[model samples]
Target: MTDDRFLYDPDTAVDPLGDAEATRAAGRSSKHNYAKVGSGRPSSLLYNYGPGAIMDLPHFTVMSTGLDDWERMWRKRVDSPPEIHAPRLREVVAKLLRSRNVRLRPHPNQPRKTGLSREGNDLGVPARVFPQWMRCTGCDLLAPLSHFGYTNTHPYRPDQARFEHERCPGRSGSRSGKNASRAAVPARYLLACVDGHLDEFPYDQWVHHWSPCPKVEFPVLRMVDRTAGKGASAVIHCATCGARRPMNEAQGDAGRSKLPRCRGRHPHLDAFELNGCGDATRLMLVGASNLWFPMTQSIIVMPRSANEETSDLAARIRVAFASKPHRLEKYEATGDLEGLRDALDGKLDGPVDEEAIPDDQLAKALGEALTSGESDEDLAKWRADWDPVDLLVPEWNYLLTDPLGLGHEDEASGLTLSHRDRAPGLRKEIVRVLAVERLRKVNALVGFTRIDDVDRVADLSQRMVPLARAARPAWTVATEDRGEGIFLQLDEPAVAAWEAQVEQDQLWLAHRAAHRRNFESRTSDTAGPVDAEDRLRPPRYWLVHTLAHVLIREMALECGYSAASLSERLYAWPGSDGRPPAAGLLICTTAPDSDGTLGGLVQLSEPERLHRVVSSALYRAGRCSSDPVCGMRTPQDTEDFLHGAACHCCAMASETSCERANRFLDRRFLIDLPGSGIGFFGLPG
Candidate 1:
């Protein structure tokens, strides 16, 4: 166990937001880059980052502390804080909550604080910092920072007084200057059970087993690297017990049996699950990218707030009522707003002032925002025009077919749209360019997983943590992003014909079976069984997904955007239960810091430019830099069994940009080869 004092350095203050000195010196507030990887994560990993997901930073790993505890980290509080204290990302939040059956409520209104450092730089918020124990690289002794000398270069010597190494007398047998020459860094090895319990590597017990120490109570332990492989080849030694063991088998399946049973620990909350759990603890490296996987869900914004025809009117109503608190009461009373006011009020620092605006004037504004002198028949016709049976299809239909839907009548959205002409040979497959002027994507960190494959887990509650200390939470912290995009709805006839092909269906099944077997093997037992519904998806879905990725890669090159800055949301589910087939891909720009409407993405939607982008993307996909070997490999031959005809140099997007965790992808179905006759594009004219 580490010294509890290192958990929080009370004397050592930090200001996470920015510092006064640094702000003044730089003539501006110090910049803070939270999560440099941008917010949108692959949908498969969304379950990993709910209320208390464990997030790894550069110097330390942090469990996203509960929302109620956020103020504890700041040194000072600002007055009249916004709903989240951070930006509210209006369009993003509105879109996500549109269909979820949950109301769109503003985040907590608390001021987040920071402090300045001596050298005029911003420091992290002055929150508690739990020391997950440190490893003395020189002696390989595992202990708290207090165990080593206070100097920059110091070895582990338990007898040394904290911050005072001059009076230590244990250096007699040590070589001159060699003793205390190297500093100990934090131990990277960690252990986690399926029960969401985390604990430090059990070094002491591993060396001695369950037997009592036959020697001194304070046995000296040293980690020695006697082999060429630094981490894998290193061996641990007990100077007191004379027992030694290697750390090479601490991660894989064979190592799990050798490792001790889990003790059930939650080092972040400073709490433990004391009821006892028998689940085998999995070994994890702190810096590994797979250690934390965030589960996220998003929705597209429709003109109608709730139902069909009313979407356009609802959007207009929201635009009118924004920034005008006085009109809220009237809007609420008239049923135009009703439940909306309460959700909007949370965004304010305090309760809405009753006297801000008169009820009659507010009514007049609301009325004017709608159709002037409109009769009940007109309203009835508008509502009748919407297909209430299918919730998402109507919204998608409006985006694809409604010309006035992307109209420039409203300037608040910062949206712009254009109708692009189809290129030769591509016209029969891709229908039209539904250019999006502006788009908002709000991703909520729902839960997280560790040392397990995402597909194996079915229940979210098993992986996620509550926002509060209680067993359940009513709220969680989320970030919303605003951006621009272009939607390309695949031709229904072309998609139907491609889906009907016998070879395409067989090809997809072969990959699916391989994927299922590989998935079962890699998934941890604790993750439980995979959901039956999530396992199988239509073949058209893969074709559209591959194209989405290819388009994003091409767009990034032509439109001056980094591939990492772009994200894709597929709407390609086959029609069922009297609904129309929804096959389209929306490739959009995402940035946590900006409004997201940079005009570069929408500009590429022009007919002439789009032709080049599609042609170039298809040409590149027909042949990869890692061809033959990459193209010839079957799903059974691949490690994950989830990819076919897709490699790092071709189909794979950055982790942040992909939605399916880079699974269920095959570029072979898109273009043709000598033996592969089922290419959807039909071999380039």
Candidate 2:
């Protein structure tokens, strides 16, 4: 079935002949073939639903297949996917994955179809029906999809696709040969383990106690709702032998004892681990927010060379080569510039503006690509000493020092910056404000987790489950977003003095103790020895982090961009592991479109306007609608919560905007509250 709901472009078409090849490549059954079921923005694939993620469609519940399936589709020339290049992000992913030749490809996309015939627009990420079990709405008859008849009456409208119990004999056996078929819905509950294995809840075993039905070989099950509230009221009955059990028996602590162990099933891969997973399965609702947590890492594209022009030119050239690898290989083999130029000129197969590239710059970039080689030996050494914290250090230095003098706009690199003069009368705590006119951020989906999100945890490698079943994947999906931002740097001396004063405050100490307890509780299930540095946040971090959320809330009101469209990047550290103390935050908005949001955010960064905004934001932060209770609230000794004196009504930003998932935030750290002297900014007069 075709649906534009998930597609970036609804009218695009793929070659009809490629369908057979794609199906074979994906190793999917005829019923589970590709048909442009749905599509999503490239960015969504990174954060919301990458490979191995379960997605809910209008009429179906499906799980995105692994990278192996995606690669096969590309190999069959089903759709030509675009390659994204961000050197820093590439290096980080390489170290994380322990691979040298990893490629960053985005979701397949095509232009609108102009021809009369739209026979084949089936290009999209491959997916398979998950929780294969379905129940007939009319009769409450429960069975696998194979037992039901599927139909998609409108090929162009995926929402119309659905399953029907074509042979539904009505609620009672007496209504034989009656056409009482009704639409089928997926079973509400699923089974998952902390090890990241997901599978359909065991219906047959639950009713039969893991034993075969004594009276019949095949049991016909029915999930009958007793018209009562809660899951306990729902009953799974075996029509064959009359064996039955309530859905509640498969949930909670008691449920673990009643349910089967994880089968190590990765439905997306259409494969299972050889050895069964020993972890106990926990019952989870299908639409629960905690079902899938994407573990993605993104980086702002930065210039590699001291010369901005050279760096920009090189970036363009690399992108051009990445889209056409055969030409890149040909050039690498023959070392012929003329031949490469001729190939590029023959057809604008890649970026349309490639024809406008200067010959000198092209030659320079080609020379660098050939010489760099990107050897595995060098990568091995780099990975050996790699620290995730170091990723922010260079970015911190670049935003503050501006060592490369990158104040000019560069369209090729997608980086435009102009330093705004800080007013002498501006707040003393704020040291600098720079308008990031244009920026490119590349986000790559490395892995994901289920049950709990490891957003702030340092050793993500421990909990993160692979996208593909392979020990090593050749490439992962990624997308590049071009946007703008406002960078703010806090005064170091003032922040340091505040940090010193808060060190001995009882309230401050209580917050610290709360954090430690929270960290220990969260990581209690983790295997290895936990490091305090990995989970603990310094007081300086809380100050900058809380301030970012406050300013974001204020800016969103006037910036034309909604709060969800804005995002924050906090650069806070207390000079650890040879890295200097850093305190800053970037409030930015990005989009998949070529031209990002208008300059509303940057306009707010003007010294005069910024002073007003910060003053208002601080004034508002000092009091919340949920205050008295909110203002007085502290992370209790027994609770595992991270934030102190921060809630949705006050300092908390949307999940998309806050990098820490709204953790390590407190208005008391940013604005004065009652008797709290820990606030960095005084209440506005």
Candidate 3:
């Protein structure tokens, strides 16, 4: 059986703040050799440790290999990796990839047996030993992994997998001692570029300054740590020629010139770019958070109307026919299903999986595909047109209208919603309340970045590092989570009036200016010009975002759920081009399992209970132990900060809960800031 230590439980491994470093540290320090070493939840593969990411295991530092490697490895196993079904997310990713044929599969996780052998069962995502350099702990001997001896005492226990410096002589120069073979840890440092190329630290080059050793062709080296607190305390010394250099010398602005140009290497892929990247290399620690930042897109799965489903099916059918022009011509000539049926019988292959599709739906989709006259180019154009905001518009409409009504359930889509009456005393503010009894969320990892978290939808193409050596990937990795939530839509008229009132307020103006400055500062390093619209945030957004945080904090205390277990989705976009404005938030929790969290959150959506929660949340938002100072705080004159009248003690929610990462929030927008007249809610006597 695969050791329990190798399996990652999503519920336990993923940090609420989206940090995986702590979990990795736990795996590294595990006392049991059979304990999990590379264990993490399936969600981690989609967020914190996707392809090309460097991961620290108990016995080794490894890099998740490219999708090409994953495919090659999985092909060897009998069972294919499980596929995730989220049409909306698939459509978005298909558009991003500019390919109609795209699939979303999660990392392979086989069910464990008590006494099963690991032999011929290495069926998980593939990872390679990274950096390839190791430092012997006992003798300070530094060399490539080739020079070390490897051992896996328990083949079934991956945690016991380790590399050792077998012939190491201790500091006492005694080779026949128990300490002759010492454990080797990965070299602490690595090299990276903004372009996402990663390479081993240039230890030899750094020590010798790009010159050959004067004493020998290949010098023996030692990384000596002085046990001091700073990077300068670590020195790389050549034992052959006595050349030495401190690690701190390779940091900051001064260090950029000392390092070589990027070789455009993707160590995980074991390949290098034909024309190397021109970007300069920077020194990075192996465990630095900036070394890998996953670029992911996620969406809450919503039920589609019958017509909408038919339309999507028709599009897929058209894409299938577009690949086989002869079949399309035959169908167009006959104007019937005879040709399509023949093609289907012959096992036509395309985006539409024939096995999963029903005969009736296939027939209806075929009729629409032939009549719609959607050419291959037209289909491509349709797939190319996608907007991130557009994904939310349908969801917003569904929550408000509840056209499907209460007790509505779609087994295929995994969506179940029941519209509840508006809470008492909140009718004027909250227009609708929805008990989202069941919902599915799909998260997909497209690419990753080095040294920065670039998540702008528009700039994703330019900023994201490719997952494969090829220009495009055949598929991306994704995972599906099912859970429940509570949706609250604010009255648009009330929200509009409040926003108009705050638009001209001095405090709001200061926050807006800070938003602009923050955007400019972040985009300053990019080569492209910044869009003016990207710097602006409507007052409604700040109000809705802040209200969500306050509500989340209050809901966590009242409900059994912890603050980290809850997440908020804001629907705050201003009206433009004849579209209506939206002001709402959805507080929800989800898990990787089929049977989601117990309805602790959905139960709180009852009218009387919700009324109390909202009232208490607003009352709590107005006062804070850190108030007076926090209340007076504003983002004005601060280029980096984007929040005002918001701090950890009050408006800021956990990083996983707040969509903006705790930005664009202000208690002053939700409740009056001391003597200010800007609050959206007034306390009752």
Candidate 4:
């Protein structure tokens, strides 16, 4: 279903064709695909990032598709991703949504499609987006994409050709001889400050800064990459004024000296300078790895409070009255408890406890709750109170206690966990839970950081970066998903024994020293006291973490899900008297908007399969494709500091699948290494 609110240039027609075929046929591609959705994205392109993210897009097409040109293109709202049905996730997600004052929509009936599709959109779901800047590759002119001409071209059908900005340098160059021959690409460089305001690079001001030549009206600029010297020696020159400057001087500390102050531009939302961010803009290339680092925290859903009953009732009521918000409104206004309950009972296919949540209370709660994201006031409040990393205490409590409460039950409410029979060393060192049912995991995109770790920032306000260009947006797009997993909790005695080792403490200290050095290098601030408790994980953490990676790799080979689809949540902490020590890892598979249970993950957890999977993973960790060199690497300030005997070939998993940002992993701790006796699973004498 197409979002009616999506902005479309009436003059342009967007086709559903995939990007590759259109590019191959030289057929007009969809302009919406650039920053919207589609399989047409180039391999080098990376989107689906939150605010503070920088990406490069080919300038020319803007969006390639059916209608080539437009008299004018207008801006519209970004459509939301399809919501996944997750009644179980509603309680926590609803609380979060409520805290932000976002409206809760009824769960979607069908599973939200995953990945971009060939049909010219993100699996047919397009985000409503309009980027503010575009750069002309031919002339190196940086301007908004809206300033350029529009065209829809199918190589063989020239009769449908059209143009908007006739005088644009990019268009002139592309059409100089005959038909338009070029498309503008997104400017590869953008600037952002610590305050989270992003803007185009001050290219014009930089080149013209040191030159004595008077600024000429309508100056022509060109980017020249010099091959003779260092890569940074590339230059930007103004033909009209004969002004020139090396690109390198405009970047880093050197660029800070030469460039103009930050203009407080937020091109995405087209908003700028309220009080004005006075910080000098730093030079950044689009697609820099640091441009966007998602600050995300996840929880393993476990049956927690009696509140679940109320939450389950709420979800049922929501789905029953989703299509009839007016009825819900009536119930809310009148507080007509009995009538509403009766109406709900008539429509709902399953039972809902009216007693758990009385009609009046439900109405009052729903009334107070913001379920629709259409109101401006609701949005403003949302941005003001946005919480990126919510406290996971409740979720953690649920995960730790609830699964065991189920006893040997194979499943409960579409969720289950079954203990496996003890293997030789399994029961002695690890508590057993072979398979888990409906392991629901919800991940939401809160904010992003550039060249800094938002996770380290203790202040909540500092982590809330602007995703919108203009004033703080009332709401931002986020995703909710569900999945199943395999659970393994280490035996407390085993973990204590492992931590007791003097050599283990030394090894952990070395990794910790490296971590401190790395942290200091990233920020000037001293490590927090909590760093010891949280960041400086015990030796058991490395062992469990590495084992998780090995198993993820082994499971990926045959588990229906790809390695990327599976994720790990490690629970490890040092023990102290009277306090419960936690040590376990939940390796599971999740999807954007599905029930997240295909049974493959749980199947691996079966007693017979668990033995084989764990054994194979440990065996593989004993060796490496880049052996000796990889296995012998030491943790130091300069290199391989965060790792030990762990590399992509052995212990590393995709960034998306790892909770620790792929750190605190060491294969040496999981298996016996040559000249190293630290393996948790005993090594030969």
Model 2 residue runs over 4 Å out of place are: 1-34, 76-80, 111-120, 173-177, 226-229, 306-387, 402-407, 455-459
User: Top TM-score: which candidate number?
Assistant: 3
State the lDDT of candidate 2 residue by residue for 1-685, as single tens digits: 2111111221222232365556777886444433666667887777777776778888778778777667666655544355676767765785666543465787755545654445335446777777788888778888888988777645456677788888576777655547866788887778988867788987888889899998887789999985644655678999999998888877679778988888887666655666667788888877778888887778888655445444444444554565466667677677676777776563422233555667777677666644444566675566445665677887787787552344676654668888887776678888888889889888888888888776434446666777765554657888888889999999988888888887777867777778777767666354456565556677888998998898899998878999999999889887766798988899999988778778888888888888888878887888889979888888666876778889999899888898887888877878778867668886642
The true-versus-predicted C-alpha distance at residue 603 of model 4, in Å, is 2.1
C-alpha lDDT score of every prediction, in listed order: 0.56, 0.74, 0.74, 0.55
lDDT of 1 at 5: 20
TM-score for all predictions?
Answer: 0.71, 0.83, 0.87, 0.71
The residue-by-residue lDDT of candidate 1 on 308-406, one tens digit each, is: 223323333444355464665565566654344344443432123324534454345345444333344653454334322244564466666645643
C-alpha RMSD for every candidate: 10.0, 6.6, 7.9, 8.5
| lDDT tens readout by residue for model 3, 485-559 | 999888888888888999999987887777667666666254355564564668888888988898899899888
For model 4, state the Cα shift of residue 40 in Å. Answer: 9.0
Error of 2 at 569 (Å): 0.9
Candidate 4 residue lDDT tens string, 1-685: 1122223333333333335446757876454333232222111121333333433333221211110110011112123423323344443334433322222222112222453322322222222223344545445555555566755444333234332334445423354533334445554556766555566665666677744447665566666653533435557777777778877776667667766666665443334556666776677665556655655434554553455544455555665665577887787777777777677654542333555555555765555432553355654455345432233334434445544543344232334555556566443466656566665554444345555566554333343454432132222333445667887877778767866873445666678778777665554132233343344556877878888899899998867889987888776666445335677878888765445557787777766577777777788888888999998877765653678789999889997788777788887777679967777776521
Better of 1 and 3 by lDDT: 3
| Models sorted by TM-score, best on top | 3, 2, 4, 1
